[model samples]
Each structure stands twice: as C-alpha cells, then as structure tokens.
Target: MLKALSLFTGIGGLDFGFEAAGFTTIAAVEANTTVAATIRLNRKWDVLETNLDPRRAVDICSSTIIKDAGPLDIVIAGPPCQPFSKAAYWREDGASGLDDPRSRTLNAFLQVIALTRPKAFLLENVPGFAARGHSGGLDRVLTGITRVNSTFGSRYRVHWAKLNSADYGVPQIRERVFLVGAEDGRDFIFPNPTHRNASGTDDDVRLPLYTTCWDAIGDIPSSSDDSLRMKGKWAGLLPSIPEGENYLWHTNRGGGMPLFGWRTRYWTFLLKLAKDRPSWTIQSQSGSASGPFHWSNRRLSATELFRLQTFPQNVKCDASRSEMQRMVGNAVPSLLAEVLACEIKKQFFGAKLDTSKSPTLAVPKSETAPRRTAVRPVPPAFHELVGTHADHPGTGLGPGAAAGARAKRDALRKFKAA
Candidate 1:
C-alpha cells in the first residue's frame, strides 16, 4: 500500500477517502484539540497538534515524527481557508485578501513539500482562494510548490481546478478548489464529472443525474423531537415558507408579509429543503439563526448532516453537536475526495480506479427529466394570510419608494431576529 501524510486533517475526512482508494495514512497534523482527539478516537495513526508554521521549516524538516515513518508517496492537505473565503471577505474584521496571517498555512504546506519531497501532493481549499482578490496568494503558493519541485529536480506537473461536490453524487452543492502536483512530470487531469445537474439541459447520457437531498437523508429519522428545532418567530414563519425557498418567498411580492424585498436577505435565511433537489451548501458555522431547515421546518440532525457530507454512517465522531456540525460542514465530501484519490492512484501508483466498492443509490428514471416545467403553486392559506388579491399588482412595496423600503428592511431584520 502507498503511504500518505495528511495535514490540517479534520476528523480524517480526506484520510478516510484516500484509504478507501487504497492508500494508508502514516501520519496526520491537526491543530484543533477537539478535532485531533476525535481523529485519534476513530483512526489509528500518528497525530500532530502543532500548527504548520513555515518559520519552523528546519525543525519540521528534521522532525522525529516524519523521520520515524518510511518514505511518503503522497501528501494531502486542506489548509485553513478563512483568509481567502468569501464569507470572511464580507465579515467586518476579515483578512485583507493576500496579507492575512492564515495565508501562512499554505506556505507551511509548501514548506512540507520542500522538506518531505513526496512523490505527489494534493492541496484542497475553498474556491474563493483562487478568486481575483486572492490570486496573488494563490500564485505565491503555486510558485512556492514549483520552486520546491525544481530544487529537488522532481519536475512536478501541477493542475488545479474548481470542483463541485454535487457533481460527484454528494447531496450538498459544495464547491472547492483542488491543486494536484506530481513529482514525476506526469500530466494530471481532473476526473470527469460523473453526475450532471438534474434540472439542467445537459444531454450527456453518460453522466448520472445529480444526487438529491431526499436521496441523501430522506430516510433519516426526523430531528423534530430532538432539541434542535427552530424557536421563536422562525417556528411560526418557516412552516409557511415554501419548500426550496427562503425568507424571500414570504415577501409581499410573493403574496406574503411585506417585511423585506426579494434578494434582500441572505440565501440561507429561513431556507428550507426541497425534497426533489440537491441541498444548498452545508455551512461550517451554522447556528439556530443560520438556516437550511428541513422541509419539515426543523434543524437537521448530526447524522443527517453527515449524510449530506457523504460521511459513512458508521464513522463515529466523538464531539458535541456544534463541533460535529463544524467538522462535517468543513470536511471534503468523501465521495469527491475518493474520486480525486482514484485519479491520483491511477497516475502515481499505477493502480486502476476501483468503482465496485463505491456506494450506489437508485435514482428513478423520472428524475432524469428536465425540471424546468415543475412549478410549485402557492398554498391558498398562505395567499389568504398575506392578503393577496387577484387584481392587485404583484409588486409588494413599489420600487423607488426609499422611505417605505427602509422601513420594510428594518422590519425584516426584526422579524428575522425574533
């Protein structure tokens, strides 16, 4: 079996996937005490608690931990992505694009490549890491990797791409950027997308339909009785919002309360699942107020969230509800990781990409049909509650009415908080 080393390993998501692809994890580094403990509880591998600091390049190079292990065939890492994340960028005290302190994590990752000189490396990060604002940081990371490869005379070939986990049969639409580098100068092409958007016009019959939210966790027992249910105004409002819609659906334009206008609120505010569609991205920092509520108007259970992330049901995570939520949300979907690992195995280890052991779900033939024609009608009770009249224009609060818009916006915030 090929030997692998993992960095920033969060609950061993990538480690498990690569192991499933026939690689053995020799060691892993994770700084979070709780996450590292969880990894130890579930996996039999050496775990490191130190942060990957490029400044400690010499000590890391000659570290006893890696020296005790044999040669490494591959190194995989999913560095902290907060510095370049879109969510962070929008935060009040967020990083300044390329200059964030967290950006050093990528440099430390490169320093590992320089020190260990593995046959290949796989780097995973948020899609926003490659965004225009952070392109310089990305370029620096690539340059650093190239420099290391050149110094070692490895002549590594690198390929990078943005991939959506939903296209690999994960029930959530999580997009990430992956950078794969091979030391032997072999060209590395990304794996072909095995699933297509179920509701789109893509006519590629070779690809399967995208996995739906129902396909992932429909059978999981409802968490409504669990202590995770929504409270306060959300309890009253969510049940009335249509499936696959959010607070925007309750706007006056949609024949509901005139608290806010369309597109004024966050996409996940009051979001509910659509039984027929894939889920929106599972957020790492989800809370009671940050919703992607079940169609039943309740929060999803830990197991349900795990299923959406494509983690095996048997995989135990010994952590609290909130910690588990962060771990699952931040994890690379095992299916997507497996696909990438298979490609790496084929390229570096001369191994065939195995599909027989992969999980398979039965998709109905009808689900493959285009979803454009499926229109959900407004419930009659909702229309009555919102005081909708047939002759009235659909416009809720008229545009260009600044004073009315501001009042409605304030009301929306109050309603959301309540």
Candidate 2:
C-alpha cells in the first residue's frame, strides 16, 4: 500500500479518495469538533483532532503526526478556502487575496508535507489559484516547497491543473485546481475524462454534454425503500414529497423555520429534474430545503444525494444529518478520487493497479457487481455516455486493448463526493 498522510483533513474526503485509489493514509489531522467526530466515525485509520488553529508554526511542525507516522509516501490536503473563496471577500478587495484564517491552515499542511518528505504530494484548492491574489500567495507557497526540496537534495516536478468534476463523467459540474508534485522527473498524468459534454464528437450515438440527471440516478427508488431513510441530523424539516416517483414530476413549494444560520426555503432544484439534463450539484446535507433540492416543494433525501454523488449502495455515512450534509457537500466525489487514483496506478505504478476492475455510471454498486469474494465481470458503460471530451484522448487504449472500462466506474464513484 502507498503509505500516505492527510492534512486539513475535512471529513476525510481526500483520505477516502486516496484510500480507494490504493494508498493507505497513516495519519489524518483535523481541527473541527464535528468534523473530527465525522472522521473518527468513518475512518478506521488513525486521526488526530485539535481545535487549535494552525497560525502557529511551532505547533504545526511538532504535531502528533510526526510523533506517530514518521515520514510518509505522500502528503495530501485542501487548505480552507473561504477567505480566498470567490463567494466570500476575495471578489471585493480587488481580489487582494483576503487573509482567510482558513488559508493559514495551509501553512501547517505544507509544513507537514516538508516534514514527511513523501515521494509525491497533492495540494487541492479553489479556482482562485488562477487569480492574481491567490496566485501571488500560492507562488510563495510553491517557491517555499521548491526551496525546501532543493535543500534536501530532493527533486520534485510540480504542475497545476484545473479539473472539472463533470469533465470526468461525474453528474455534477464542479471544478477545482489540483497542484500535483512528484519525485524528481517521474511522469504523473491526470486521468483522461471518458464522458463527453455539451460539445460532442461526430458520432451522434456517443454521449455529448452529460447524460441527464435522471439517467445518472434513475435506478434508485424515490422512497419506500428503508435504505433511503434519513440517518444524519436534520438541518431542517424534510420537505414534503408530493406523490411522485421522480423529481421531473415536481410541483410548487414554500418556506418555514430556519436551521443553523440558514432559514428554510423550498429548494426547488434538488427535487425537480432538469429538462432532459443532469440534476443540480448534490450537497453534503440530506435535508436542506434549499433551491434545486426542493422540487415543486419536496426535499431530496440523503440517499438521493448519495446517488447523485455516485456512492456505492452499500457505502453509508454515519454523521448527523447536518454534519453528514456538510461533509458530503465538501467531499471530493469518490469517482473523481478514483480517477486520480487510476492516474497514480497507471502513471506511477505502471500496470500494477488494474484499471479494468471498476465500471462507470451504468453499474450501481451491487452484489452482482465485483465484490471481495466474487468473480467480477466487465462493468457496463452508460447508454448516454458515448465519446469523451475533445481534450481527453479516452483512456489511451492501445491496439486490441481494453477501452474506457475503468473510467466509467471511477466516474460513478466521483459523482457522489464531487
């Protein structure tokens, strides 16, 4: 197993993705009480929790991680981005890279990366990395990493790329920046998205844009199944489901009491099916009655969100409703993680990790699908998923070789966390 470590480990999303990809995280560092509990409950691995902020360099350089898992194979994390978030203060100060308290967390994450001296590392953050404000700060962070690498006589090639979650065949259209690093001159490539988008190739039969939201999750039941019942803490009252089998058949809705700092509003988008398109972005909370979630007036359940995010039927989250919702909202879809994992296996391991083991959207996680004890069959492709993005070469299959099999399976898992 590729021994790894996670920093700024919010609800263990990156940890989950890397693990699914085949790496074993030796330690996870998180500071939020609720998030800590979520990580502890979900992860069987060791997790170190502290509400203490990371502004203090001393505290970060000497944490429990060093005391436990000495030096790792890789270090990964997404430092908090709200301060630099476009949705927050970044847009106002002429995009002067707001000093987000959350951004400071990155200082600690980087410190850990240096200490661990992992062979490879990945730093994930918002799209702000492209802007002047964030770019300026990130430039320093990058330089610092390189400077340290030089001192250690260690060679690292660092590259940054903006990846769209949907570009990889995930149902949602989320996008993010992945800052990838590797030892010396080792070649590490991101996965080629196998799903096509709004733009299509010459073949009309192949999928263009996305397979609709309904197509992504048409197999699961809207209700009446015990597995779909709510398990997390309710952020607000569950929106009343109008008698209907699908979100496409939605109706008018309303508002009521508030939960947390957010008030209740009929989230019309979650329940209403898009016009022959995919549904809105799935959130972490299962019961938020925000728009897109509330169709006509009914709220989308946690199970439905799980499906949209592309989680297997058997994988279940154990946090309270609100906590689970927040965790899911912030998670990197499992399928997306799987794709990243494939890159490691293919590019880093070179034929060691089999890409053919997983399927795409067409196969829901099932007993019929491959399992720990069963012989696995080839996974199917979604009928709507045809040609890949013009940019993606479609898994680079060789003569008489397997094509797109693993891409689809990874995409299915990513949709849920992404």
Candidate 3:
C-alpha cells in the first residue's frame, strides 16, 4: 500500500478519501484537539495535535515528522485557508491573503515537502488561493517548490486546478483548488469531470447527470434531533421559499411576495435544498438563518451532511451537534478526494487501471425524486419587510460594504481631528 502523511487533517475527510483509493495514511497532523480526537477514535493513524507553524514552534519540525512516519509516498495537506477564502472578503477590511496568521500553515506544508521529498504531494485550498488579487498565497507555494528543486537537485513539477465536487458525482456543489506535485517530474493530469449539469441538453448525452441531494439523503430516516429544526425569526419563512431557492425567492422578481431585494442577503440565507438539484456548498460555520435546509423546511441532519459529502458509513462523529456540523461542513467531499487520488495513483505511480472506467466512489443515481413539499403562505409577521425594497447595488456597494465605508471614514475623521 502507498503510505501517506496528512496535515491539517480535519476529521480525516481527505485522508479517508485517499484510504478509499488505496493509500494508507500513517500519521495525521491536526491542531484542533477535538478534531484530532475524532480521527484517533475512527482511524488507527497516529494523531499529532500540535501547532504546526514552523515560525512559531521549533519542536515540531519536518525532520521530526519524517523520523516518526518513516518513508512516505505522499504528503497530503489542506492548510487553513481562511486567509484566502471568500468569507474573508465579507469582513470589514476585506480578505487578508497571507497576512492572516492562520496562513502560516502554507509554509509548514511546503517545509514537509522539501524535507521528505515524497514521490508526490497534494494540497487543497479554497478557489481564492489562486484568485487574481489573492495569488500571493499560490506564488509563495510555487516559489517554495522552486527553491526546493534548486537546493535538492530534484525535478518537482506542479499542476493545479479548481474543481467542483458535483462534477465528479458528489451530491454537493463545492469548488476547491487542488495542487499536486511530483518529485520525479512526472506530469499529473486532473481527471476529466464525469458528470454534467442535470439540465444539460440531449446534445451532450453521454455524460451522467449531476448527483442530487435526493440521491444522497432521500432515503435517510428522519432524525429525532430537535436541533435540526429551523429556528429564529425567519424559521416560518422557510416553508414559503420553494425548493432550490433562498430568501431571494420572495423578492420583487420572484414568484412570491416582495419581502427582500435581489442579492440583498447572503446567498445561503433561508436557502432550501431542491431534491433534484445538487446541494450548495456547506458552510463551515452557519448562523440560525443560514441554510441549504432540507426541503422539509428544516436543517439537514448530521447523517444527511455526511451523505452529501460522501463520507464512508463506518466513520462516527461523537461531538455535539454544532461541533459535528463544524467538522463535517469544513470537510472536502470524500468522493471528490477519491477521484483525485485515483488519477494521482495512475499518473504519478503508474497504477494500471483503465482510464475510461468510472470511479468506484461515484454516488449512485436514484431512479426518481420524491414529491416536492407543500409551500406555506408567507407569515403575516414578515409582511413588514415587504414592499419598495431597493436591490443591492453591485459589489462594494451593498449594505455591509456601505457600513464598512462609513466606519473607515469615521476613523479617518477622528484621526485628522486628533
């Protein structure tokens, strides 16, 4: 079996996928104590629960990790990506890129690659890692690899692409950037997408339909957990929103009453899942009004979340509801990881599987979708938010953005007065 080392191994989602694809993860490094404990409970791999930032700690060096894990065929890491994720853009000052201290893990990951000199290494991050303005994080990674090549006289070539999990038959529409490098200069080709939009025309009939939420969790037994029930002032409004829609459904342009302006709210606010469509990306942290709620007008159960991410059935999460959601929501869909691992094995390690065959991890399609839930009338309590609402102006002009601008101006005025 190909031996693997995992870093930032959040609940071992990526590691589990690699294991499914025939790699044996020898050790997993995670900084979160609860998350690391979850991995130890489920898998036999050694769990190192320590801060891995090389700039802060000399005790946890790449040499020490190498000495303990022995020879490794692959080093897989999904370093903390908050510094380069879209969520950062919503902050008052905007995305911090590499400036966020959390981003130090990027260097820590590259250090392991330089020292271990594994045959290949894989890194995963949000799409913003390589965005036009946020390319600093990616530049540092490529530069680190180049320096390693010069110092060690090795030919490590890198390839990277942003992939949506739904395109590979996972039931969620999560997009993430994946980077893979081979020490021997072997070329790595990303796997071709095996599924297409369910609404595709007959002209491109060969590809399978995108896997839908119904396919993943339609048959799941309803949970008794009351925490799964939608709460807050907007709870009653969810049944008014149709499947595959959000708060926008009640906007002036929508089929329902004009309760909101177009693009005024976060996309996930009051969002409800359509049985036939793939799920929206699961948020790592969501408030009471955050959604992609089940069509039953409630929150998705933990089992449903696992199915949408295609986590193997045997793995059990022993945490409370909120923590379970946090860990699961942050995971890379395991099926997507399996798809990439298969390609890496074939292209980098010369595995002899036929290129044309479908991946074993693809979620099976269901024969038919269930009946749509009945829509309820918008509650009278929310009637006050309706009428004459202005749509959000473009980016940097929304209410949140306007509020941030005012705060900045106020600070500047105070500074000038002083």
Best by lDDT: 3
Q: What's each prediction's TM-score? A: 0.83, 0.67, 0.93
Residue pairs with backbone atoms closer than 3 Å in model 3 (clashes): none
What tens-digit string does per-residue lDDT give for candidate 1 at 262-316? Answer: 6655678888888777888887787565678887778888778877777755678
RMSD for all candidates, in order, please: 7.8, 15.5, 2.7
TM-score of 1: 0.83
lDDT of candidates 1 onward, in order: 0.75, 0.56, 0.85
Cα displacement (Å) at residue 90, model 3: 4.0
| Alpha-carbon runs more than 4 Å astray in model 3 | 56-65, 93-95, 201-203, 354-358, 402-418
- Write candidate 3's Cα lDDT for 272-347 as tens digits: 8999999999988778999889998888987888899899888888898788888987789999999889889988
Candidate 2 local accuracy as lDDT?
A: 0.56
**Candidate 1, residue 26: how far the Cα is off, in Å:** 0.9
Residue 382 local lDDT, model 3: 90
- Global Cα lDDT for candidate 3: 0.85
What is the lDDT ranking, best to worst?
3, 1, 2
Give a tens-digit lDDT track for model 2, residues 1-418.
6777777778666666677677787777677777877666667767667542445445654667555556566777777655554444312222224344455665675566565567788877667755554574467568867876877877777777778777666666667778777765486777766566665566633643554455555555556544334333231223332221122222221221111111112233234444334555655434433434423233456666665666545546666667667766776666676677657656655646655555333323222211112112212322122222122122223211132334444555777779
